[model samples]
Target chain A: MDFELIAESLPRLAEGIDETLLLAGSSLVIGFVLAVPIALLNLSNNGTVRTLSSGYVYIFRSTPLLVQIFLIYYGSGQFRAELQAVGLWFLFRESWFCAILALTLNTAAYTSQIIRGGLQSVPWGQIEAARSIGMPGFMAFRRLIFPIAIRQALPAYGNEIILMVKSTSLASTITILEITAIAKKIISATYQPVEVFLIAGAIYLSLNFIVTRAIMLVEFWLTPHLRVDRRIPPVVRRTPAPVPAP
Target chain B: MELSYLGWGDAGWGDEFARGALMTFAVATCAFLLSLVFGTIFAAFKLSSNLLLRAVADVYTTILRGIPELLVIYLIFFGGGQLLQTIALGLFGYDGYIDLPVFGVGTLCIGLSAGAYSTEVIRGAVLAIPRGQIEAARAIGMNQGQRFWRILVPQSARYALPGLGNVWQFALKDTSLISIVGLVEIMRTAALGSGSTKQPFTFFITAFLIFLVLAWLSQRVFLRAEAWANRGVRSA
Candidate 1:
């Protein structure tokens, strides 16, 4: 490894970091919003909706993300005239939108499954209690059901986030000047793949470390009862000597 | 005015596509087997009493799981070449031109990622074995080798079937990424056909269907194995 070359390339690689973060962060946020409803549809009793949702998930999840990106970027361009006529070509003109669209759809398929599993694990008693309290179905689901499911789903979702962050490397294939793209350029120019990739790996490790810690904090905050109450272990609700019939 | 590029005749890509599918299967099988070996070693390390060995296993799994498959492949393909060349110079005392073949590099990358996931599955299965079973073997005067082969290995293999099946599917799909390193797998072949024929939709759809078939077939095989393994047990 050439220390001088690595030192020289640090700033340029750092510039790539911003684009990398933008690609991953934007796709993750958008993917999460889209996945929730898809998850619900997937779990619905309606056969048609369930089949359609599951098929969407299957197709997206089964194929590699690279192919999906290529299809969107190049395959869809085959219809540029038709898309342009409908005023959608403006969005499709840039590689950024294509990368985001592909990543969003792919991540959504995965996150929806994670979320569906979470919703399925919600205890039936909680929903029954909500109904007994005269709470409306939508109100009960929003307040009681969604909260518990989110907590259970947070760990898997955190894994998904890390996967997405690493996946942003694919954006480089679309000519996006993300970290990997920049690293590739640096290597071609200088013939130093090992050093550049090591730096890139370090960058990813640090970013994922921060993201994992943030999610852990969120999980802790959401389930305060699960945390050990420093004051006592289990605090066991003492009967206080039967209280003399008080 | 023509859709003959996808036809099966001399001018069509029918031949190329078929060859690509064959390559995908070969690479996937090789990589899967390599992963099983790597995974078994790492799983054993994770279960070992030495803290340093356990830590090495942990770090290996973390880096493999934490990074993208694409990045890992790139690292293996490009960095692998450089590392090999360096070692060749140092150890062999001679080096003219050193480079890892595309297939070698690709298999290494895929196997590396697959092994990380398999380590978890194998470790889980090993843990799932009832502690008493091992104790019983020991009490019966079975040696370590006998106990491992007769009891631990068979039992863990049965329990690990489902998770290993999923990993196989993952390995199958991830083979597509190796196309970047010029392996001519389904994905790369589709890409080449699309670019040359300018019919991206036709080839991409073909690639997707091939993977779907592989996934379905692998799932069936694993399910059959699971049933066979559970033969003596009472079903609930």
Candidate 2:
């Protein structure tokens, strides 16, 4: 109900959206890059590769991201001396780097699973057809398998993206001044936790809404053939133009 | 740095960590139960004939699902107390502090979020139940309550067990967030221990192991439950 306070806080909270987006966007990009190979490894016939990637996914998925963030951010402090010796302390020392690193790893685990499901769902008959046409292995995978798998995975990956966006708020606990952090700051300043949180929640909800709509657009684009209009025939009128001509 | 720091009794945080684990279990259980109740109600709303009820359920799930759990927790913890105090002042002319317990707020927040997810799962499970069975029950002159208890509940529960297992895992992990509100859960215990001992890696790694064990054990339990639930049923 404190209109003036909420009005003053809106602009400051808006600034944090950039930080939130950057954290989520970069981590998602990196996580996807990491997920592809892991998903492939998960589908591999080689037992060792499959086990290793499965283990990676299990460890990351089973643990909470908060502990991972703390472990990376604070745990690294315990290794500062050795990291500095290796010239890697610079990366470990920044909360942003640690936050993104944790987020990337956690997301990669989930994404790999999504990608694996997609890959598995790619019909073996399609791959066989590509092989029968003399398409090379890598080319067949890239052109035939990968495209189908990605389209199949897009919806689940969209959910993952929303999750990662919401998760960026946890970085606030690590001293990252994202929206939640900014909201907390405002709450302390004005003693209006309810108003501040309402604004912050609305911002997050809108961001997620946009993300969901964007993903749905991509889903629609990816599967145009699945659209009902695409399948239905257009209606035509015969002999109606003769009267106009007369 | 000494191993004794993790030992039980006067020298270590072993007792506190154990107690914290118990608290985590307690919180997760309460929240999970609350989530199931909320989820069932909302799922019914979603499946109801009324447009208004369905829309209300949709909005509830969407908004809760969209926001971060941490912010929700903070909102309830801080804002809930403020609202209660204001209401007390207005209605009873009382000018006293109203403190909502952190455990209640934490459970409510986690329950609300988890309920959104559980709504989807339960709805899916309900939809998975074949209509023919319900029809058969009615043809046999079974009452609504008997049909519900005998056919609908068991079948939907079988279908929902796996999803509910995932929700339980989520709830367990989410209990960690409660530490931010000063609850003496495992995460908070680890934080306290690490802060006092200046051994962040040690305590956190301990916490990680504890969570991993819980996740592993829960997975086993769910697997067993799934097997039990599917007893005598043919697998596709």
| lDDT by residue for model 1 (A1-246), tens | 789888888788889889989999999889999999999999898999999999999888877788788878877777788889999998887999999999999999999999999999999999999999999999998999999999999999998999899889989988999888898999999978888887888778788889999999999899988877567556577666755655
| Model 1 docking grade | medium
TM-score between model 1 and native = 0.93
- Model no. 1, DockQ: 0.65
Task: Output the lDDT of residue B113, model 1.
Answer: 96
Candidates' C-alpha lDDT: 0.88, 0.93
| Segments of candidate 1 deviating more than 4 angstroms | A230-246, B1-3, B87-99
Question: Among these predicted structures, which one has the highest lDDT?
Answer: 2
Off by over 4 Å in 2: A230-246, B91-96
lDDT (tens digit, per residue) of candidate 1 on B114-144: 9999999999999999999999999999999
Model 2, A81: alpha-carbon shift in Å? 1.5
Most accurate candidate by DockQ: 2
Error of 1 at B220 (Å): 2.2
Query: Among these predicted structures, which one has the highest TM-score?
Result: 2
Candidate 2, pairs of clashing residues: none
Deviation from native of the Cα of residue A135 in model 1, angstroms: 0.6
